[model samples]
Target chain A: MSYHSAVLSGLGTYLPKQIVTNREVAERLGVSDEWIYKRTGISRRHRAAEGQATSDLAVLAGEAAFVSAGMRHVDAVIVATSTPDHISPATAPEVAARLGCAGAAAFDVGAVCSGFIYGLATATGLISAGIADSVLMIGADTFSTIVDPHDRATAIIFGDGAGAMVLRRGEATEPGALGPFDLGSGGEHSDLAAVRDGGSRHKRSTSPDHEGDYFRMNGREMYSHAVEWMTESSRKVLARTGWSLQDVDHLVAHQANARILATVAQRLGIAPDRCVISIEHTGNTVAASIPLALAHAARAARLRKNDRVLLTAFGAGLTWGSVAMTWPHLDPST
Target chain B: MSTILETATRILVDKFDASAEDVFPDAVLEDLLSDSLDWVEFAVAVGDEVGTRIRDEELTDVRTVADFVAVVEEKVGALK
Candidate 1:
């Protein structure tokens, strides 16, 4: 007859060693490095090596999370991604197996860029409903595999990386307990961002040419939608949590774009200092963005114990969500 | 000038830093605002001023300032 809250325990992140600078893609996309930086606020991004896979990144992050948590296993493993290692079998089980969490309930979640927040909401329920006492939640993606290196719009916008968090059951009064969340989707605008092929729709198509498998984003439309939805979602969650804009200690939003985060923070009346923009070094890591930002912020000490941290993200499915939490003190190595 | 067009022009001038003279009707959009992001930001700012969103579809036919102002004026009119 009690509610269990999913409390934060640890954080870890992994970025591939191969750092791809804007110059690498700009030449192909015919844009200057300064142009890419001026627009996306990215100087470079990490690209997975030829043999590397999404699961590989996830496993490394999961292991790092375990070390951060000082625990070797958990009751559940959830991998959030759009670029999975395989389509038939879910990616989580392999990630769990690779991380020595074989017996833990494992699965994959898809919400594109909002994957981390979506995974957080699901993991919180798993704890609240007593489905799992602890969960290893990971947001990982190899977007480089799906992005067209020559596409001027998307090529320089994405990077490959993974970030994981360990969550454990705790009381609501405990530090790090996640508060209310606002999760939503605008299915009507799904066409605004998508990979137009290789799915059931394309499989059933009569066309013989197998093409358009690359990720495509209408950055123009996406800009307005992302800023509006993320700001709205942030407001909703903050209201549900009974926190004012000024009460927020940090706004760790999806590193989708520097401009988007600034707009959302401005619309919400959150100060620029409170807005944690970690994408300058990593670019947009798709579903892995939030966790990566959190780990980056945590390691930098931007996050502190009992600090009110707001998390919001908008991405591919035209989905958006926000989660409120009081930061928990974790190992300095996080 | 119509209020809607004025709002559009103010956004272009104040928010996007488009020169007041350059935001007039028939002004080439590319000549006024070169960045691709400027169009979307300009639309959102105009939407904020007009109290109704300026959808992306409405901006498709926009090649010149006259064309964009027309769409904004029409959308604002429809709201009334």
Candidate 2:
């Protein structure tokens, strides 16, 4: 039996209205703006409004994706997020419901920065297995909700945003059809990037010293592992797709940092200009990084139809993944 | 002199962006390296030169260049 191919039909993204400049964070942390920029390559990031949650962003992005695709309905919804509205009742259902996708199959994927790729794989599988003809995959995270305000290391690196893609069943040979995937995780090094509390291992504390609830990252270790895993995964996917490095037209890597992207691109022999980067303004939106970068590139007309695109990401849980695709025609602004 | 030690010292100097004289055998690795990335890169560079891999756990008790050299020597010896 032949399986259907999942092709990306539309893309959309939503960044919160509250912008936090590096200078503002630097002032509070007693660091120079240049110091923060030199370290993370981030100038500013968005923080969710007081009442805005991850689902709120997801709904907006999902609706925009539907509008871009010129479709009113999808069969399933998959939200990739590290920060959910609550521990129970996954954010996908609420996001789907709000997008008028009520009664559609919905759930959440938890691969942190790599959540979008994982969600893409899950959505593709659903389409291939005939479970869904179309799926709305949203990568949304309000990392600002979990980061410590006093910790400059993380404060300078994260932002809240959401990006969505509409995938429909199509033929394998068509443009926008996802290629083979290379996915992996290193459970042993999970602590390299994580939130220590509000989980089964460590419950939320009412005590005044409940600092563990905030996100923590060992930058040096994270850099090493991120570069290693993302580079390896990108190579694996390129190899699986039977495309050489030189044949890649665009490389969209997770907006973890400028240094990591440069290292990965150098290792893969991908030219600097060929890599899509939006982190300078958006910061590291975690799971939203890949799609947001892709949409940004598309909006700028940097992406063209049939361009060979390679996507990769590394995140908490030590998760990493890569996927290859041909750029499709779409109005990214929608 | 052990070639592994010489190679390890060279890697340390390069990683720390310091001179050979500054990267003494007794120098603390954490003190010389700016961050964990430097430490990991140093280990990787040493492993590349000596044909050995350094696990993160192995570096836990290693404080000085001599400690890292000893670990490398042990791994190199085990390869023989």
Candidate 3:
């Protein structure tokens, strides 16, 4: 059987209109604005308006991706997110239906911040295996809904947004064709970042303490593990693609934090100029981080066609992954 | 100069850009390191230098540079 390459044909991102500045968060958390910026490298972030859900953001991003690809249809849709509109039915099916691609194979991929790359890997497989010729992949999250406003650690770091990409069956020689991927998980460290309640193990009602409903993260442990795992995984993908750190024109890492991005790039020997960061304005949009960063990079002209881009992410569930691809020209409207 | 204290101090200076004078035996690790990432990296560097695995739980009681030095010394001694 012949395998086809899954080429990233288009990209789009949607950030909610409500902006929350560091000053506002600092005043609420009783910290100086400079302290927040110095620690998280975030100046502002967007919050979804009331009545907005993960699926709403996903649908908008998916539509933009379709428009960017100049195609009206896709064979499958994958939504990568930790926050879904409903816990029962997956958000992808609703996202696909809303985008008018009803009945298309649609599902959700949950890997927290690493969701986008995992979704990309899944979409690539679907296309290569001849299960689908084209795929619409989206990473969306509304983390602010679950974040405890009183917790300075999480409230300041998380924002809500969505990003989507259109992938089509194409040739491996194409500039946008994705190269090899490296993915890994450490379940033992799952507690390093998670929401303790709302899941089967600890149902929301079972715990009287509402604090368990909010997201919690061991920031220090997460930082060390993130840098180590991302660096290791990035090196693996680069080796798989026969590309060196010097060959990467843009290191589009998950915008978890600016400090983490800098450390990972430093460890990988990738220069600061080669790193792509949109987190300063977007905050940590969880699963939406990478694609949103990519879209922002394209809009800023920092990412050009045929440039070698290295993508990596580490998030809750102790999940991390990396993918390499040469940037492709995208529609400006996307 | 090759004692565990001196070696640990050297690792801290190299890994965290701490001044040799500031990294005294009494200096608190929390004061010297701003965030958890710094502490984690410091622990890893110390472990690598001393040829011992430093567990996170072991660092709970470690406050000052002397405390960290003692932990490293204990682990290295166990390896011997």
Per-model tally of clashing residue pairs = 0, 0, 0
- Per-residue lDDT tens digits of candidate 3, residues A122-141? 99999999999999999999
Q: Rate the local accuracy (lDDT) of all candidates.
A: 0.88, 0.88, 0.89
Residue lDDT tens for model 3, B6-30: 8778877876778888989899988
Better of 2 and 3 by DockQ: 3
TM-score of each: 0.94, 0.89, 0.92
TM-score of chain A of each: 0.97, 0.98, 0.98
Cand. 3 Cα-lDDT? 0.89
Per-residue error for A212 in candidate 3, Å, reads 1.8
Residue pairs with backbone overlap in model 2: none
A114-198 in candidate 2: lDDT tens per residue?
9999999999999999999999999999998999989966888999999999999998889999979889999999888888888
Each prediction's DockQ against the real complex: 0.56, 0.33, 0.41
Q: lDDT score, residue A324, model 3?
A: 95
**Fnat for each model:** 0.50, 0.36, 0.43
Residue A323 lDDT, candidate 3, scale 0-100: 96
Q: Stretches of candidate 1 above 4 Å error?
A: A204-210, A332-334, B73-80
Query: Alpha-carbon error at B12 in model 2, in Å?
Result: 7.6
Interface RMSD of 1: 1.7
State in Å the error of residue A306, model 1.
1.3
Kindly list the interface RMSD, in angstroms, of each predicted candidate in the order they appear: 1.7, 3.1, 2.9
Model 1: pairs clashing at backbone N, Cα or C within 3 Å: none
Task: Output DockQ, candidate 2.
Answer: 0.33
